[model samples]
Target: MPNQSTNGPSGRPKPECDPIKDEKMGLMREVGGQAVWSLSSCKPGFGVDQLRDNCLETYWQSDGPQPHLVNIQFRRKTTIQDVCIYADYKLDESYTPNRISVRAGNHFHDLQEVELMDLSEPNGWVVIPLKDSNDSPIRAFLIQIAVLSNHQNGRDTHIRQIKVHSPVQNSIVSVLDFPINFTTVQMAQHSTIR
Candidate 1:
């Protein structure tokens, strides 16, 4: 057998990746489109549509003052585990967000700050957890992303993409779906190891 060590076959230590983060992207479902996306101020042709178009070339560019905002409002209460934002420091330079704030509540008027983060120099998708210290996902009707500042103190900012994710709920499996509804005892007797 080949090496079964932490270094694997390459003999280089594997980069550590948060399994929860990987699950958020791989197993979870994207529910951002279920909400209404709004922006504080955006340049024409570079608005919410571009920010969520799932493309890297297009981006949402803020046109107004500091503290650019992107708001997500749901019709009903939603569970959000994390928010992913794609940014390129090399490409956007001064327009790259340096500080970000996440807020959530029932509405805009009663929004409460959830998390504040400072990004040094990001060049790819940055995932921010919406969970509390107890590791519970945030449940709210409104979720907001505020760009407090940008690199090099740039007034406007460019955000290539944004995604809101929630853990995938396992669908209930029933042994009674067949034409002959199976009883509990019948299921137990018929069950086999695959």
Candidate 2:
């Protein structure tokens, strides 16, 4: 049998924790539907699924070297107002991107720099507003990592979360609205939409 105490089981002090690590992980709280970030490529474990996994403790890390691009194709053409980026800058300042360019268009060939961000701060959520084009919201968006802040200690860039805020145009759906004629099986036979 072992002796026990109120402070601890053996009256021993608990080991200290890394505040920076703790601060970097599991830091944001926004309860809603699953995240909507859709990307093309990332590391195996750090894949697109983690980008919107509802947990800030995990992040999607880009693979390979510089000039990493994340292509986002929303299910439908979304009228993007702005985006919220949650990155733990204090923990990984070097690997964090210093300059990011926003490209918005219906097709890949049409992508052009709509907005540029020279991000400086870190460790929390930063809302990057999508540049309104001629007073019109962006239909679809892509994030181009223009410049990466070379971190002496890290190589891969870390992105905790990227949330798109597309305001609801109107919620007044007619009761007469009917479902599409095509079924799941039919859609699957035609193409892999999902």
Candidate 3:
């Protein structure tokens, strides 16, 4: 239902030009396999489930023996407001907090954890905001959640879903445009009713 239009050389529509038609034709083209990973199930160490269910028994460690890492990629620049990391305390009963490491752009230097909040609901979500002064525009990023020795092999962490807002400049190829009333009326009267 949204009307999308591209600016032409002149303000008015050019001869034999229909913005809606062009967009519809473009949509016919197939752009396949663009996403790196689709977040489907909550695995053992992704740190997503904790936030989805509003629990924080999972913790990350850096100096511990084994370190768990979650890798994620955004096809384009995105304005991320909140991030959720999930983990289970089923394995460990300790109350020690885990360290969360974030990396953007490359591995040259990592971004420090800006904010960490416990989910309000019993099994809700852990919301982490991307408001750090040092936070840079990110297309691809990685999170490392390491469990301390005290909590190792005790808690199972799972990353389920990540929600973000549309970037200022969204993917041009994915843009869609709608037809005006003239075409709408014509299709409604003449098109096959299936």
Candidate 4:
């Protein structure tokens, strides 16, 4: 008789984890919903809601001229480590963003460009890490996504989704890294003699 078991000698199934499919697979905290979102222009039905609904079929369609903007503002300053944007060139074609610029600052008036990306017919989620010259995460209260151009010179743009992530320190690792504050006498006092 042929054996049909697929498990290893340990009798444990293999763990399956795909980074692309898992939205929060890394040590990062998603903070997109905590901020206020605004768009430069949008169609009646296609707006920020569609972009954040986590549905690939739905997208935020801009109706204005070139350089469409999506502004995200937070009440308090926060560290921004990465930005993920979903775009389908096959579905949206010319509406897909070809050039993107990310800006960060305390406010709109003082916004400075942090990263510039040029995509060539991207079809899935593109993650752009925001880092300073010193390789540290950017700290700001405002973040903006600017679509400078679209595929095939399209004026408007279609963004399926956007996610902002901040670096997270593992609790266990942080606890282990903490300095030992108690002296030997203090440690002994806490130990049970019985």
Candidate 5:
């Protein structure tokens, strides 16, 4: 919900790569098995833009449990001191709040307790922070959105675009200034002759 955008040194807007249509989301797409969806699959006359209602739902398999991964890349023109990712999905009474996981570098976090507020309108979106000291330097991040259902009939969930925003980058300096310990060097130097 917070404005993740920040100004760059030159005051130019940070470059953004929002999925315009279903095709664009494909470039950043990852799926489990054969499940898929796109803008073309949507009803005619619906605009394929960065909005909540443009995404389409594909096949819903009742058997075999599996999770999917969706990844997207964009330019960080500024320092990006911090960032938040948002996602929108549809849900019903039978729907259970799925566990959404976010990974930035080696760090992984989870978002839980998600529920649907309105059925007529698209469900609310969740925001997760992507900044952690232990997290690796994130060139890009990957989000795994999934839900587990016990119902005999599986339901397909429609997903809108995932948005990324942050301050722009001005320089190419290392975000962290710290020495990394080399395990090989330590072992060789401290080796004991037996």
Candidate 6:
């Protein structure tokens, strides 16, 4: 069983993930790509997949101790300027990160520290701008949680969502191939879930 963060008439937290709000990475939809995304550790049913849903209801909850990590690898070099993280939206104060360390590079072992963010009060979603010395793209990026907020009596760190910002690569256009005799009015007559 899981402990409910809120009950009764608690208010819903602000939604920070507006996929269509930011024009840069906003207009682009999440698609299957060569980039590899992984988490160092997560509780069952809460994994990296939840981070892409754009909804706060689903999230990635970290297991074990502090310093949980989120790692990403690109198929080719990609330029990313900022990263957004939504946490504690439902008021699950426990496990919110106080400080975060960013590491990135072309190679895994060769990754270097790029930036660090210190949140005195870790409460809502944050947009962190990544700094690249050369101002160029990299092949990999990593985020490590250095400190966790006190929960009073709770376990596990919770992250409601995460988004990586980068230039839109490929645009997919779905073509509808209906019956040759089918007219526009007929095609639009009814809709099917399939």
Question: Which predicted model would earn the best TM-score?
Answer: 4
lDDT (tens digit, per residue) of candidate 3 on 1-194: 11122122365532332222333555221111232332223444533433222234433322223333444445554344334443333432332224443344433256444333322111222334344355543333433232222233324333332333222333555212444344677556744434
lDDT tens per residue, model 4, 1-194? 11122233386632432223554665567889899999999999899999898788999999999799999999999899888888989999999998888999999899988888777787777777788778899999999999999989998899999988888766566434555566699685644435
Residue 10's lDDT within candidate 1 is 75
Give per-model TM-scores.
Answer: 0.78, 0.61, 0.36, 0.81, 0.33, 0.63
Clash pairs, model 4 backbone: none
lDDT-superior candidate, 1 or 6: 1
Clashing pairs in 1: none
Sort by lDDT, best first: 1, 4, 6, 2, 3, 5
Query: What range of 10 consecutive residues in model 4 has the weakest lDDT sum?
Result: 1-10
Q: Model 5 segments beyond 4 Å from truth?
A: 1-65, 74-97, 106-122, 134-156, 168-194
Relative to the unseen true structure, what is the C-alpha lDDT of residue 177 in candidate 6, on a scale of 0 to 100? 45
RMSD of each: 8.6, 17.6, 16.5, 11.0, 15.0, 12.7
Give per-residue lDDT, candidate 2, residue 84.
63
Give the higher-TM-score candidate: 1 or 2: 1
lDDT of 1 by residue, 18-107 (tens): 433665567877889899999999999999999988788999999999889999999999999888888899999999999888898999
Two-way lDDT contest, 3 vs 4, winner? 4
lDDT of each: 0.83, 0.56, 0.34, 0.82, 0.32, 0.59
Q: lDDT of model 3 at residue 164?
A: 32
Residue 29 lDDT, candidate 4, scale 0-100: 78
Off by over 4 Å in 6: 1-20, 23-34, 134-155, 167-194
Report the C-alpha lDDT of model 6 over 1-194, residue by residue, as the tens digit: 11122211254533454544765445543322346788878889899788667687888888876667777777666666656677672366656665666677776677776656654344555656555556554335343323334344345677777766665666565444443454588675554435
lDDT of 3 at 14: 21
